[model samples]
Target: MNIRFLAQSEYFNGLHLKDDIVLEKEYEQGPFTNLPKVRYFLYYLEENIRKEVMPYTDKVDIFNITDCQSESDYLYFIEYVDMLDRTYTFNIIRYNITDHTHTKIISLKDNLKLYPDNKQIKIFILDDSNLIIQRALPKVSENGKLKEFFDFSLILFNFVKNKQIIIEDENLTRNGIEFILPYSDNNCIMKTGYSLFQNNRHANLTKEEAAVESLFVVNISQFISDLQLEQPNLVMNAIDQSYYDTTVINAKLIENFLIYSKFNYENNDENIIFYDIETKEIYTCINKTTTGEYLLKNATVIEDTPYMIMKNSTGTQFFNLISNEIDATYPVEYNVRFVNNNTVISTIVEKNIFGKETEVVCIHKFPIKKVILQEKGEYIGCVTSDKETSYIFLK
Candidate 1:
């Protein structure tokens, strides 16, 4: 592993949280409070400049990019709307960085008649053709007052032709679905959460259970067929659940290898299971105080040997994906991002000459992994506000 200081790299400036930060800007007083809009506080490497793409208008109370990500040279932005009718709308915005001259907005409300009551929808874009979207479980009150939604719909959209399929599990109204591993070439894994999870074998146990983690392998082509044909039953394989730890909070799939973890947010401890999809073999996963969200990634594949980044209480380590073993450990308060075959990016905070802590973005040249080789090219970097899904490769 090698590190090179990327003085040319840009850092994130974050979102607009408060209104009074800029005293010169005036606003018309309104009775309703809206979620904070993107004030376009971003960092540029070449020159110091601020650019706002979608500015707030008179008719719009809030315009938020709930999520955005990059695939190849294109960027996809998910914009959410909060309406007065207690209905929600989603607009998919597509932008091309290579051309920069084209932008497209596809509104869900215009295509589909269904309107989600909850604006907080989770989405995962699998490819150019497929999208996995889930509606969250409504929060239950102390008195068990349940809110009404049309149904708990998990939609799989083949967005190319505006074709979509919805899978709703009515018996588990209180449960929420999350995207897990990619099961096959055309399928991925989905898990249930947000409430008590009852394992099938322990169904008769009159006591509480861990977060209900139901694993399902959903076929893409069959799912769309069922929905388009107006079939009554959805065709999906429901995998048997076992009492491993608690629930699978997050997962990452690499080819036939899958890392499933049951992460407890409060205590910072997680139980992991490594399952091989092709062989149907399960490996007991070990973690040294791994605490956080889905930060697990393919560390740096060397040659044909694959490796991944796993975490502990102190820092991270490079674990072999095939052998299921740890190799090296990285220190605390730093994150490693595999930009591509040409470059690797990591963020580290260092104390400057002014005795102030400063974030320094380090860039590493690739071909570090001899295992899987890719064509190398000249790469440029840009930073976006949404760290969770945002990627900037502006040619």
Candidate 2:
């Protein structure tokens, strides 16, 4: 079983009084002012034990008490341990003074030596607590002996202020080494060992190295936000026409636009609508399912056409056209049956005034299953199959 104990000591005039001891306030302020309160408290408790049953020995040894604080706050805990174990076992005792309390803990264990010669220890001091670990000697020393022996130096990569890695020596005679790690201006630190030349000392990259590194860390989300902000019109046009596929439009395009737009609409909403010509609709949904709604009013039909227009409620449309110059030699009934079965159905429209008759062709071979006609135009919504459920845009 694991066990822990805590003691509190209060000091009045300095004559530390244990929990069992009863003393008046006036007497505590006078004769007991200079006395060792902790020592007296321990002595009084030991005296109370029956000597015949248990014999006590003068083997108590107090080791070093270390106090440390953690990075978050300044509260501290002091830890004290006994270095001697012989004959009698000990435990912690609490003493109370007028205003404060002092505590001393005791334990029974084999005699243990701390900080032996040639022994190395790692001491982690935090705002509220500390941790000490005995470790083997490090290969490198503050005087750069490791480099001298190995004939190679260890250099820190991506050095930057506030995110520096430091190596310090325990003795004052040895100086410490500090290396700054690179971090973005936004206080975000990049992961180490990214760029071969930037993080590796042996790599010999040339002019393209800087450019490669810049592209590697460019925040895509932030870049897009800034670009849309600065060049609102350009971004709006791109979104309106689904121009994201262009290779020339990179992160820098959006980044510059965002920087420019920052002054005008700092708190504007970021959701956007994208329109694709192939799908012929304003895509609003992204991810999950590949489906979106199209406004029927946005559909257009060319005049003097040879196609029949159909619409649907889910924002889809289809155009049907007939071929005038048919191969009549196959027989009229056979040709009509072939036309009805093999005819293509689609929503795309192509105009050709040079043709003898208005020619309307379907871009897709799937049949139109649903249509919704509105006052403004006709919208072809859903298809006979799932193939027409296409084009998704994310905000």
Number of clashing residue pairs in every model? Answer: 11, 37
**How well does each candidate superpose onto the true structure, as a TM-score?**
0.51, 0.15
Give a tens-digit lDDT track for model 2, residues 1-395: 11111122332221112222222222122112222112122222222321110112121222222212111111112222334443223332222333334333323232223222222222222111112211322233243322111111111111112121222212100211111111222211111111221122112322222111111122323423433233322121122111111101111111111100000012221212222222323322111211212222222222222222232343333332223221212111111110112232233223457754322222222243322211111212211111122211111
User: Residue 73 lDDT in model 2?
Assistant: 14
**Per-residue lDDT of 1-395 in model 1, one digit per residue for the tens?**
32222232333323322111100122344323443232222223224434443444222223222221212344455444656575546566554433443344455542122223344456666555666566653443333434432135567666787777765444233345544444554666656544222223223222242235567665655654565554544455565352334445556654455666655434556556666665766654444565344334443334434455666786656666677677555565655544433344555667768997655455534323222322122223433222222233321
> Which regions of candidate 2 deviate over 4 angstroms?
1-114, 120-122, 125-395
RMSD of 2: 32.2
Residue range with the least summed lDDT across 10 consecutive positions in model 1? 16-25
- TM-score between model 2 and native: 0.15
> What lDDT score belongs to each candidate, Candidate 1 first?
0.45, 0.21
